[model samples]
Target: MALAYFVLGDADRGRANLRDYYLAIGPDHADQIARSAGTHTVALKETIESFAAIGADELILLPGLDDVNEVDRLAEAVL
Candidate 1:
């Protein structure tokens, strides 16, 4: 399992496997799975303040953020 692999300290491989699996199943299935799990799935295309206003407790920059200064500022503001 992906989570099992992650917990076993192979996060890169685990995440890759999970991503591949998700892609294979496609968005509709992924959305269904997310709904069944009681999660509100969303794309991270909005500003940090907007996300915060929508009750986001934490933010993960990932591919959307690259500026170190901005990242630090957001981290400080959020955390």
Candidate 2:
């Protein structure tokens, strides 16, 4: 969505794109996430793996990060 804003120069479209994919985390899902947070280091690793498995391209994830190196790493893939 951020990429949409950047490329199209349309804030509304970017917001619309974001809204299209937005999932409202209800009580049950939130509770499950909270329960999962109580575990050790591997919990985070597993969660990230699951997220990765859900399939997002580099461009979609780029604008959300703060690291220049990671941005550089994924930028080429987007291009």
Candidate 3:
């Protein structure tokens, strides 16, 4: 997404704001965050489908990307 922004002459930074957005809230909170993220993905997919059904013309997605292996797994899973 940031790369595409760069390609389109917009100087948006993705990786540059990581520390500002993420926090080390410890292991217990980690599991909750993980579970919430998973649930949110399901909700988002349904919402997007519903919007599409109602004639939504534009949808932009910044996927839930974490680890390097996860990215590769998702790429293989979908692409």
Best by TM-score: 2
RMSD to true structure for each model, in Å: 11.4, 11.7, 11.1
Off by over 4 Å in 1: 1-22, 27-45, 64-79
> Clashes in model 2: which pairs?
none
The list of candidate 2 runs beyond 4 A from truth reads: 1-30, 57-79
TM-score of 1: 0.27
Q: Which residue ranges in model 3 land beyond 4 Å of their true spot?
A: 1-42, 68-79
- Residue-wise C-alpha lDDT for candidate 1, range 31-70, written one tens digit per residue: 4433222111122223444657777776544321223444
What's the lDDT for all of these models? Answer: 0.36, 0.35, 0.36
User: For residues 1-79, could you state the per-residue lDDT of candidate 3 as single tens digits?
Assistant: 1100001111122222232234376555543433333223345455456657777767443334443444444334334
Error of 3 at 48 (Å): 1.9
**Residue 37 displacement in candidate 2 (angstroms):** 1.7
Between 2 and 3, whose TM-score is larger? 2
Expressed as tens digits, the lDDT of each residue in 1-79 for candidate 2 is: 1121121223244334333434365555543333333122343344445556666332234222233553444344333
Task: Sort the candidates on lDDT, descending order.
Answer: 1, 3, 2
